[model samples]
Target chain A: MRLRFRQSLDDLKEKLLVMAGMAEQAIQRAIEAYRVRDTSICDLVDRGELAINRLEREIDQMALDLLAMEQPMAIDLRFILAVIKINADLERVGDAARSISDRVRELQAFPVADLPIDIPRMASLAGSMVRKALQAFIEADAQTAETVLSMDDSVDKLNGAAHYTLLTLMKKEPNLTPQALNALMISRSLERVADHATNISEDVIFWVRGADVRHKMGEKPATEKTGTRS
Target chain B: MRLRFRQSLDDLKEKLLVMAGMAEQAIQRAIEAYRVRDTSICDLVDRGELAINRLEREIDQMALDLLAMEQPMAIDLRFILAVIKINADLERVGDAARSISDRVRELQAFPVADLPIDIPRMASLAGSMVRKALQAFIEADAQTAETVLSMDDSVDKLNGAAHYTLLTLMKKEPNLTPQALNALMISRSLERVADHATNISEDVIFWVRGADVRHKMGEKPATEKTGTRS
Candidate 1:
């Protein structure tokens, strides 16, 4: 029974990593769609969303079944609960990808001038953070999770740059307002994806170290950074 | 032991409702601050964030504790999981409120001009949805949760209106681009609050009925409408 329970937990983790990969790919494709003005990539995002949604439901059911049947305790219980919360975050990250795809569709409908912003860079950072967070979860690597946390500030800086740049562009060339606004929305979506990644990393830390490092109210205890990368 | 477990779960639920109330008020005040261009109210939102963050941690810890201690099964397991998910959504709603407050501060920094759109109505709808979602959770009213789901479409409509109106205003009155963009961001924040509220309501339904109505792929038999108002 104990072995089966452990296997069930591992199975749930594997499925969550798969779902995370799907969300990350959707985000990557959505960014590419923005760069190439490719509506076909948006179609890919839309189709991929169905799979992500289905994965979310499957994971949720597996979690419920594990709880009902095995009655996991202590760290196991925390793991299941963390999976539920992380599942929601992953689903929202998928939604953010869909949001970006929708914005790309809007930009296609209304021909817009080129933006002087680093939107793809922002998306790339956010996507990397998401991928790293999942890898940390699969490997139970607290150091990688911490790295994901540190990258959040950089994503915020990018979002701020995107915001101010769009504001200035809108002021200078009012004709670019619609496209600039769409680009700003895209930046916001990427920022949210990064936030979700941070959430996943926090859960991984909790899972591995049995510590709650969220909200970051107190000074984090100084420790030599472990070189754990998966 | 079972009685103590039930009590702890109830306590967690009550605390969640209280946190939900605080977040709803913050969202309401943030909207008022935006409408009135009150920087002080915006500051209130900034200060109140710490409390919301702390409540989120507290609720999360409590949910995990209950799950570990009680090893709750079936509906009980679902209830604890729902609390964990709903707690995250509430914290995000607080973040949306803070975003609106930040926009209010930015708007106040600039010279006041004739507003380009109806933002308060959108904010109010978002706030009401948050409140009603909590009410649904407390009462286990799946119908009210469904109502919250339906209302999300209305918020989306308002967001579209806000965007189109602001885009036209920016095109017609190029000088108002900065202020118009700020208003657009504020409207986007309101739409996000509604989205979070819908997420909470969906969690409530999942807790009560064990049905995942999230992506609209699964059709569960609707429960009787518990028309309870909080």
Candidate 2:
């Protein structure tokens, strides 16, 4: 029975990792769709969303069933709880991708222009954070999780800069308002993706160390030396 | 032992209700702040946010402890899980309030012209949905929960109308782009509040009927006829 429980836990971890991978790919694809104005990529993202949603439900059921059957305690209990939280974050990441894809579709319908800023960099940072957060979970590396958290600040700064720049652009050229607004919305969507990734990293740290590190922006995380910069 | 478990469950429920009330009030106050351009209300919303965050952590701990100690099955298990999910939704509602307050501050700084539509109605709809979701939880009334679900569509329509109006306003008077953007962001924040409330109502339905009615939006909820919808 103990062996079976361990096997189930491992299975749950594997399933979660799979979902994480799918979510990360969806974000990447959505951003690519936006950068290239590739409606085909957006279509792919829209189709891929169903798979992500299904995986979320499956992982949720697995976590709940494990809790009911094994009644995991201590670290094991925290792992399951973190899985539930992270699963929700992953689903929201998928939602962000869908949001971006929708924006891309809208942009396709309108005349396209060369955006004045680098959106792909923002998307890259957000995507990397999502990937690293999952790696932190798989490796149980608190340092990697901390890195994801610190990266969130950079994403927020970029989002603010994008907003300011877009506003200025709109002010100078009224004809560019719609396109600029679409770009701003895309930036916001990417920032939200980074936020979700940070949430997942926070869950990973909590699962590994049993510490609630959320909302403690200034305070040092419990696993500060592992990967945290400040 | 059973009585102790019951008491713990009741305690968790009470704390959640308090948090729900706090979030509902925060949304209402934030809207009032926007309408009156009262910076003090925004400050109050910021101060109240920390308390909401703390309550979220406390309720999370309580729910986890109950699950670990009582090993509740069936309806009891569903109730605890529902509390966990609802706790998250309420925290996010608090976040929506904070976002709205942030927009209020921006509006005060810019002093935009009068809005073209009724924003308070949007706020009232979102707040009432949250309140009704909580009341449904307290009474275990599926009908009330279903009503909240339907109201979400109304909020969505309001958001669409607001978005279109703001877009036209910005186009007609390009100088008002920043102000129009702030108004649009406020509307988006209110829409998010309503979405979270809808999530809470769905959780209530899941708690009562053990049915996953989230993705299956068209079907009538299992407990739809029993309770009065107000």
Candidate 3:
């Protein structure tokens, strides 16, 4: 491997981390907006999305150029491919944050209800998953990625519970129907963020271990199921 | 440029088409189940998901092997990369179908309502998007892919209408809460299917013209916004 190619790879990773930071901040701000009914935070999320989208294109182009020029093989090849996949996930995470913010904007027009759903708690879990998944990607940690995968199930369960709670609330008080549905959509968006994080983690595992772990429910680690190619 | 590599690429594309067929079938079956309140079609969707998942793994492995082994450049590289992205989209399409089927199974337990939601029409539109997107991919037709992108807005509008109508129905008759909510969820799933189709079409355009058309809303075609690399 050439030193210049290694530097380019490092640069790609740095850009991806910057994009991840933007996405994480957007989610945090969106949740903060929801907590305090602050419409300004929603605006912040909307503004951040453009930068994230731009970074996505830059990172994708960089990775593609690396693959095309260097023609990297083995672990280097895997790393570039993983970066491409993670770049897509991070952009979608930003979109999810924007979606949550969209709901917050809608909720601002309606009366705030003391809903039974713990959306803040769900957002916190999802945020943690995003942070952990990015950490796994940075360090190429398969175990951390696996932990992120497990956390996805928890987030999913919370999303289901939130849906049920909102539905019950809407049924009891018809006036709260729109507000409850907005909350439900926000919960779903947060679940999608967690899902994108899980995808990044899966890509990390694939990068480190060269194993396809997706849709293999209850499957063992990459080494046990399919021997590492790297 | 090797004959064997070309044959391998052809084989990968064939597998992708087969997987696309399975995904399309799953969506069709799930919608049929919802329309007739048939639990059996839902069962078939559940069964079809396993095949889709397996095909996803096979396609990913094949694409990765090609990238690593052949190390092809130019259009071959783009084509393989596009296949990988489209493969992921198709699998998600399958998952969306399964989600709709899950809702259908729930609806089967409740009394069916002649709700104002045009879910069947939404499903048809979304299904055609998937088919046309795949056709664009097969032919590398940027025009068809652009058409698929434009159709996404319509599906989104229909999804919004479904949400509005279902919410109104639920508020008017609280007894229809669960059933209406299921219909609402099914509508959302179909919307997601359309989204995945749009993603596939975007990948098609990217592959055909070497232009990143994503996130360039309101922008003209590749020749106008960005010149073609091919």
Q: Model 1, range B60-114, lDDT digits (tens) per residue? A: 8777666656445456777888888888988988899899898888777678878
List the candidate 3 regions with Cα displacement exceeding 4 Å: A211-230, B211-230
- Itemize residue pairs with steric clashes in candidate 2: A143-A226, A143-A227
Task: Answer with 1 or 2, whichever has the higher lDDT.
Answer: 1
The local distance difference test score of each candidate is 0.83, 0.82, 0.84
Off by over 4 Å in 1: A211-230, B211-230
In order, the B-chain TM-scores come to 0.89, 0.90, 0.90
Please identify model 2 stretches exceeding 4 Å from their true place: A211-230, B211-230
For each candidate, give its TM-score against the true structure.
Answer: 0.90, 0.89, 0.90
Candidate 3 has a DockQ of 0.29
Estimate, for each residue in A134-215, the C-alpha lDDT of model 2 and write its tens digit. 9999888889999999999999999999988998888777777778888888898898899888878987887777633433
Highest-lDDT candidate? 3
* Candidate 1 chain A minimal-lDDT segment of 10 residues: A221-230
- In Å, candidate 2's interface RMSD is 12.5
The TM-score of candidate 2 is 0.89
Candidates ranked by DockQ: 1, 3, 2
Docking class of 3: acceptable
TM-score of chain A of 3: 0.90
